[model samples]
Target: MQLNFFPLNFQFTDYQITDVNYSDELLLDLRRRYNTSHSFFRFGENIYLSNSDSDSGIDIATNTTSKNVYGDNQITASLIKHIFFRTFKKRFISYTPVDFYPFRFFSSKEKDDLLFDLLPNQLKGRIGYKKMIEVQLRLATIAGKQQFGFVINIARNWIFEKNCATLNLEGYNLLNVEVLHSEIYPGSCGILAPNEEFIGIISEIINDETAKVLTNEGEQVFPLTELFIRKTKFNIANYLDFALSPDKTSQILNHIESKKQEIYNTKSLHTEICEIAKALFSSKLDGHSIEFMNKDGFYFTVQDKPLEVTNTFDLKTPTFIFDPAGTKTNNNNPDLGLSNFGPYDSISFDIKSPSVLCICHRENRGYFSKFLADLKDGIPSSRYFIKGFQKKYELTEVNFQINELSAFTLAEYIRVMKEWDQEFRPDLAIIEIPNEFRKLKDADNPYYQLKGKLLSYEIPVQYVLTERIKTYNEYILNSICLQLYAKLGGTPWVLPANRSVDREIIIGIGHSWIRKNQFKGADQSKIVGITTFLSSDGQYLLGDKVKDVAFENYFEELLNSLKSSFNRLESEQGWQEGDTVRLIFHIFKPVKNTEFDVISRFVKDITKYRIKFAFVTISKSHPHLLFDPNQPGVNGKGAYIPNRATNVFLDSETCIVQMLGVKDLKTAKQAMSTPIQIKIRTPQGNYNNPELNDMLYYDLAYIVQQIFSFTYLSWRSFLPAELPATMLYSNLISKLLSKMRNVNGWDADRLNYSLKRKKWFL
Candidate 1:
């Protein structure tokens, strides 16, 4: 291989090989004659040495005599040495003397480029060109290796302005040794090197010798072509080279393009959805007036009253009014709403288009503010196309009677909204609702106390509740409308989407602390500890699954795109065996999705074929009946209970013992002490059907693949399915589901419907 070497910074000083050595005796004699202390030698006013003996000036003799070795013709090697010595002495004397004290090199600030600032008055000027070159050499060599990544190259016209320096780095590659050398000098040349040869030598050595060694066979490795060089106040650092593969680079470009498209798509969708929503909720009114529908009314204060009714001479200007008669408005903000349509104003003249706006409520705690700050810092400014502005208003919370809310109170709320419209005339309004509404309405729940108080006002208002309701999508949309109506007085334009409630619940299970240590044998190892935590249980449960599935499909598409982009051919048709993935299944209690029930039954229906299976139950307060069954007694009935003589202890092996239907610390301890052959302890405890085990696994694989799209992603940190657990689980599930789908006598949808109709969820 042809290796190219480039020493990054070798130009400042030249390296020379020498055979001559000065004798210690000679130096000692010279010191004494000069009357200089042996520790401090001085040749003249400015020339001095740290190791010299005398302070007096001293000079070495240039006289030389020949020495015969073979006695053939006299060879004058001594003469040649004398000539070199004499010449060096003359050159040294001719140049101005400058003392380079040891402090210049040994000083604490020697590494600092600003060391000159810390110099002693007398020693400052003594430190001149020679000392500077020495410092520069040392710094360059040290920084070269440390700062070898993140290279920057400047265009010819690039100019950098810094304190005490202005660098016009024309056509400068930060990695170039010459450029670095130039940066060390004073004045214009400080940014450009005087010794090009020295720089060239450094470049050669860095490119081949040092960098090559580091790259091919060293503890550190770096990319050669992409060698990085960075500059700072102190010094320049260099990194060896690395280059991105063409395919990877192309993939990144594609990803960027996809991101741009996604942003565009989201904005477009928001606009369309907003338009549709606004059209549905708008109502027409007389000139310069508009009406909107609302379930919960929001409160606002008008700072100024509009002009009284008067016939104006100029008929062209549009007139806006808040309330013809003085009226009171509502206090608390509500979100319940519905779609309505209305004319912009009663006048025949067309109203100007309302500006669509989006508002997010101010979080009481600073958590959201901090999150936004982090987002602002982390996300590139270019990524956020919209400029987000926010403002907050403080108002007293008021409660109106239910009758007041429906009629006069409602009118007052509308009036306040109109007043707000006169000022900002906002097209849309956004509001936040309490997230804990379930407890309030149930049995004098403390949570709903506020809602009840507001309802007593009897106002026809818009409101959004913070409840985990089933199919709550419609509620969310209406709440958005309500906020708009409450704020705009005259409806501007706005839309909202419904929220989904079928609230999901997740359960986590673990063994109790006391039982964990005492029950399991001390000598027995705890290698596999099973703990189950609920992923999600609600109407929108597994909603993330859709995204995952899309990502999976996207990955496949990406691969295909890669092949086409690079024009590569696939060797096989259809999906190869290795391409298929296995899935793990987890179901939270109180599943509301009818489709999932159908899937559960399908697992049972295909149980004729023997299949391995596992199951667990999770609960915090009560032991599960299905999994934590009572252990057998001496009479084959039940074991002795801790509190009641007639009651038996529950079996720990049962899935029911697990909290949240997943293995946790508590259940793990129980399993350790329990007998291994206790078949009843296994998860599928309810059904000893071996065929169903395989079918269950098969179905799980299908579900995960269908949900996530790709089989490549792996699941980590599970109790079982060792080595490649999630993959294996997914594979098995897929196989089972495929078989069920093809079963001879079953209808796919019918099977699904059965699971929903029959609550087989335990």
Candidate 2:
């Protein structure tokens, strides 16, 4: 297996650095004075300086000391990064730094005219004159070794193509615009600006011609026509509804293969950087120089083979149990399983005759009828819900439709839903809405308003886009019926779990940011926490405890909520004293050490039982990609895509798992799939710490296998999801809570009742 990493070979293990007494003010001044000739970075509590030239004539304080860059992984990594940044900036147009490594890189010359042709008519002349290909790089320790390498990928620089004012006039909300030209404080966006150099977000629109901008100098008025908006994904999406598609992905790959042929060949950039390193550090190293590892080029070949795991349904084969008795099962597929034996837990599902409310525009009545017909009676080569759900689960349908005019407003949607709730309480609702409704603000969006209003009445809603109905197929209905069944409190299948001596509980913590005014880009935004609990078998236990709080109070609230949940479950599940219990937390990307501290303290306090826990973070935003050069492509596309469940251990505590692969890609239009990186946080402190010991003894392989299996448990579709069910469910809850928080009188607590255990968010 080949990674996108290119290894760098150093001629000397130690390099000299000028150590200065670190003060924020002094360090800032030094950086400003020697911005081009030197690199200054902070490590731990101390600051160090590296010069591009041995005798650059730059001076620090008189008491400065010199040291060698040896020992300490963090310090060594920091030195390499600073030196690379100092060298790369002189050759390329670098953008704002993303984390420690400068990920975004652009060429001095235009790569192609692709963006020019793809730009909308209104944005053609408003864009920048130069178009470049953006190259992203990641530096990491590969193959569990201390050796460093750069992971590279290329994309079209759409960000540099257009300006902010062009998007603002094109109907974009200019509340949180990024500024590209600010020198004092770059990439700072919000209301608090300390000086004129710190001018940031547009706080308010004073008039059609003027706006109030918060800068360091104070709240100042600026001409709307003159304000330059930084081109970002948010602004572009809001203005043009742009998203990355297969065609765009293919175009990017093709361009890189042609124009930037050295990237794939791993030749041009590697040699050029080696020469730059030699010039920058040869004199500083006292006679040594740097170069690239020439063994089979710069790419690192992963020595460890990827481990492949398969999902099991009943502690046996990879199959689905279609009935409560476990007598009927199908190993073929989820759809075929349901068609052959019915849904799991069908015997106990009390809903005998389910009533569905169909809402659509009057002009879409024809499409609505056809959709309903396909649901009731299966389309060609598909099993109808009547045969599977109605026959096996005794769930006959009592359906009704309400078609409003095309000009219907949000108020009309509320009125109709309320009337329907009072007259005929529906067990479920299937609303057909136009695609444009997705572009509206959360408070004004009919989709959220209607869904929240119905959910308050204990009715789950499944929304279908009108465009989808026009291109409807049997497979679409299959996925829809699966979600509808699960939403109605029916279990399609459960992951196979071996009965073990220890009890295990998986908790997923997900959050969403709620802006004070979403459209106006208010700096004051609160975070809503969503927590989902699940058994080891991937069964969702209850409704999430959703809470909205200030950023500073989020972690405290999260800890308190976890304690409450554990207390309730101890009594409910009959957890006995001295029983071995394991608590595993699956969270999204966490930015602080507060989460580790919180979970560790919680585990230590539970004296009644022997507790073991794993705090795992699953992230997809990193610049890591896995490639299988020997694998065959799907119809001559995505040849390097690995298979699902293929995992490579980056180190003792980190592993990257591919959730979707070649088999998962149904069409050539799909973009190349990326894997999710899972890292288990090793407990801090000494080996004598019980928490540290427990974490160290836990098998990481078990955690990775369980995560892979849980991805198959998402009832939303038969295909495996990119995220495991724990994270997926929590994210769904967080998104819905954030969207409905703006709806007037929408009580999220209503979910604690009958809908608590159902898949309402599905």
Candidate 3:
């Protein structure tokens, strides 16, 4: 196994800077004077010149300062990054700083040639396109050794240009746009000026020439000519629908490969960096130079040769209990397991006479009737709802013509259903929606309106796309039935747990941002936090506590909800005094010290039981890639993909796990899969006290193995999910809650009452 990292060797660890009183204004002036000269750069509050020569007016100090370049020091990292930015300005046409290292690179091609030439004629002038390449120089400490490397990928950004205002001369109603500001400095790189911009969402079209724009500062009036519309993935997708032909797609891919080879290949990338390093060192920067550890004229390389210091955990295939007697079981596959032995709690499944209501266009009545019949009676060679689960359902039909599936029509239908038969509430609804509905705004979308109304009546729905009905097969039916069973409050299966003396609870924290208006992007978006609780066996306990609040208040609300849930669990589970309780939090991204501070304070307050906790972050966006030379490839071709479940320990508290492998790829054309990086936060501040540290001592191997097992517990599908059920469930809840908030009169609290224990989000 080979990593992308290379080691660096510095000739000297010391440098000198001018001793001057630090202020924002002085730092700005110094940057303007020397930034373009490739002589000085700003790091935090000080300006450090590259050389000790007295060319500038400022006096130089004789004293030398040192930075820990090998360790996790921010000053050293920032200095190296700044040097790279200044050097690369003369190479790339334009650059946008994403972080200290990662940058988006633009070419020097003509602006007219950069547009997406394959777009339809009608959309050609309305959308702007740019071909960008993302590159990052990563530095990290891996396996007790410091390393550095580069990762590169292609980025195709579809922008809405200022010409959109001219295209729609009548005036724009609701639009999301970005306004360019020339005065702002574009980070450390001085390649371009207009890249410094801010977002504005147009709410009301005042006239053909002006509009009311809402920004972070406040609502203001701006001329249409000054605003450039902002296009998101969702917005661009509405027009192209990702409908590129095979030839066009192949052409684009070939162009990407050619560009990558020109700059991002290992040989070319190393040469470019080495050239810059040579120039900088030759200039005698502060009378010192930094060099990389060279081996055969190449940077030092690291490989997973012995496979030492790495731990691999193989999780056992979970078994399903299909009968009350616990006599029948299967562990290989969920679909075959359930088909052979039925559901785990089939005997106690109370919805024996389930009912389904169908809604579709009147013209498609025959198509839906056949579709529902197959679902109820089981398609050929497919185990379905009735025979497989031993439950029959009554069917109800409702039809509407084209352009009739409106909010008014849905409300009237619900009213008529309630009036005709007081006891005619259906257990589930199967609605066939057109694809065009996806293009509408949330406030005007019939899909959201229908779902919100159905959920209010305590009815779960299964929406079937009209385009997919023709291509539905046994595999699709199998997956759909599994979800329907779970949504109807039935347990299909659970992961076999290794019983322990201590009780453990896993909590997953996920969030989504909600803009004030879906069409008009807002500067400040509210956050919706979703918290999910599960037992050690991966059985979801209840619906998440979804709260919508400002960003500043999210953590406080999360802490309160967690405390209340823990208190309830302590009493309900009959936990005794001095009993050990372990809480492991699996969050989506790395959080701040404040999160730990709040959690640590909460644990200190509990005296009845001894509590231990670990905060683990599982991220997939890091610039790390793992390649194995020994692994076999498809069709006897070379493939560097590692096997699933392969874990490499980066350090004591961090590891990378490959959840998908060659077999997981549906097609050979799929891009290489990247593994998720799992990191356990180290306790800091007061939490690092000797007594508390002892309580927080967690086995990193066990925590990772448990997470892998939980990935098999997502009831939505038979195949294992990329992420564990904890994070998956929380994310699903957050997204749904965020969208439903736009529905008029929709109450999130109602979920706690009616669908609290059911997997309705599945």
Instruction: Let me know the TM-score candidate 3 reaches against the reference structure.
Output: 0.76
- My TM-score estimates for the predictions, one after another, are 0.17, 0.76, 0.76
- Model 3 collision count: 1
Worst 10 residues of 3 by lDDT: 295-304
lDDT of 2 by residue, 299-368 (tens): 1121122222222111112456676555777664766677666767767777767888777778888888
Best by lDDT: 2
The superposed Cα distance between candidate 2 and the true structure at residue 253, in angstroms, equals 19
The true-structure Cα RMSD of candidate 1 reads 36.9
Model 2: colliding residue pairs: 164-229, 193-216, 194-216, 195-216, 195-217
Please report, in order, the local distance difference test score of every candidate based on alpha carbons: 0.22, 0.63, 0.61
lDDT of 3 by residue, 411-469 (tens): 64455344524556677777777788777877667677777777777878788887766
- Per-residue lDDT tens digits for candidate 1, residues 1-762, read 000011121111211111112555654554455322222222222222221222332354332223232231112112122222222223333322111211011111232222233334543432311111110100011111310000111011111122111111222223323221222223213212222111111122233213221211222322232232322211211111112244543443344344433322212222332332222122223222112111111111111111111111111111111122212111111110111112111122122232321111233223323323322222224322111111011111111111111221223333434444344432322212345534343333322222222222221123333231222332232333223222222222111111231211221111111111221122222111111211111111111101112322432332232223111111222223223212123332212232133333433432322222232222222211111123322222222111110111122221111111122222221221111111121232324455444433322222222222111111111111111222233233333223332333322223221122111110
